[model samples]
Target: MNDYIIRATAGNGAIRAFAATTKNTVEKARSLHNTSPVATAALGRLLTAAAMMGIMLKGEKDLLTLQIRGDGPLQGMVVSADSNAKVKGYVFNPYVEVPDKYEGKLDVSAAIGHGNLSVIKDIGLKEPYSGQIELISGEIAEDLTYYFAKSEQTPSAIGLGVLIDTDITVMAAGGFIIQLMPDASDEIAEKLEEKINRTPYVTSLLDMGYTPEDILKLILGDFDIEINEKKEVEFYCNCTRERVEKALISLGKEELEKIIEEDKKAQLHCHFCNKEYNFTENDLKEILKNAL
Candidate 1:
């Protein structure tokens, strides 16, 4: 199924929910970075969550970034998303690997070890809003849940998963986020907590051909559901040769001259998409003129 995200409200708008199916998106990341199974699982989960969270911002130009820095083999991961649901990211160690914790599951926690999760939001503010929290489980989901409750002061339940095939490709990837608004009654919150705790793994449901709407329906079945919006999500990077040229100019004339004198050429790589841009002697001279 094509990747998409659905936003909905339940319990008479007292409960807000978001769910997404991101198999294609995750597969694209694996292909771009050539990530190992454990790295794929860790990065895929964060990318899925970032895609959903991207649309949470109120402005079109807003941006959200989710970054995890850990002590394990995976090292760290970063995901950036815009309000349009355009998301991209990279793992610090895409080739990192670890034995599966069990027959069917990748060892994401061990691959991430103990670490910190950082959330940064830029809404054209003088200073972007930032929140940092200790990683709870390095499993992505539990860490995000803790982030919401402690950092954002919102009670939330987040479940994220990525199923990697034996061939090291993504088989299924998806997640769900449910939050309690202030008007939520005690009974309503309690009921939702109970239901979410009992639901099957989100990726397992995706493997069964469940859409984001269906996943939300299963979780909010008893409560009245108001489907708010639907949007497509994908692995996207907005890097270009023009952007790279401007960056080289930003380094100032002295720096550009040193590059021309020492290296003779520059090869710049975009971490998000792993795209490389090469600038030769002539290209560096052209950029130097523009810098002046």
Candidate 2:
């Protein structure tokens, strides 16, 4: 119940919502990638839809990534988020093992088969505004609702989930993202697509303890809400050790002198939080004298 995120607006604003519950930020990313219950329900539904699309960034060092490369056997995933929803990710086969798309469901679109779903963003951009598509149902919320209706043309309705618990942890992660505001009409987008086709699986209403403003008032309860902001999402990982010694001195000086002549000592790990960054051999000769 602590992980948060909420930002609202209803018919009066022609719908623009976002919700989140993220069971302790996907149980701290399934305890830092010990993932399995289907890679913790496919990286906990893309980390609860990148923490509600990272508070729908608008600066404050905005950033959002969300890659998913696919081709099955869980060969993809790489979330990131900021604008205060703080996230992190990893899972290019976190114990890949595909099976159940039936009895008790956990196939995450067959462990993410077909590929692509990149959506960069980066805001203080001098370039960062990428977008890609394809995976219409590798199922990270319908490839982010077809990447927000073809890469941000908006008109969306995403609902991710993540339940897994018979010991594998994360009892319920969360999600919801309902957009439609270009003077939304057409009878309020056909009554929010017939009340999100009759609600229910946002991790089964966060396992019945629903929050994120009660799942946006159970799907915009007759469009009258207008909350706006609440944020407090987590599982952050701003990796450090002085940002991995400035990324090993930006890999210059001949790749830090061939990692001090063939791995004299350099650990590096951080796939978003597997943490491990030990660089000895005098810390690669003081990071190659700060890379010359």
Look at candidate 1 and give me any clashing residue pairs. none
In model 1, which runs have C-alpha deviations exceeding 4 angstroms?
none
Q: State the lDDT of candidate 1 residue by residue for 1-292, as single tens digits.
A: 6788999999998999999989899999999999998898899999999999999999999999999999998999999999978899999999987888988788999999999999999999999999999998999999999999998889998989898887989988999999999889999999998998899987688778777888899999999999999999999999999999999999999999999999999999999999999999999999999889
Worst 10 residues of 2 by lDDT: 203-212
Candidate 2 pairs with clashing backbones:
none
Candidate 2 runs further than 4 Å off: 1-28, 33-46, 51-120, 123-160, 170-176, 181-183, 205-245, 248-271
Q: Rate the local accuracy (lDDT) of all candidates.
A: 0.93, 0.86
Candidate 2 residue-wise lDDT, 188-271, digit = tens: 899889999999888678778788798889789888998988988888887779988888888798978887888888988989
- What TM-score does prediction 2 earn? 0.37
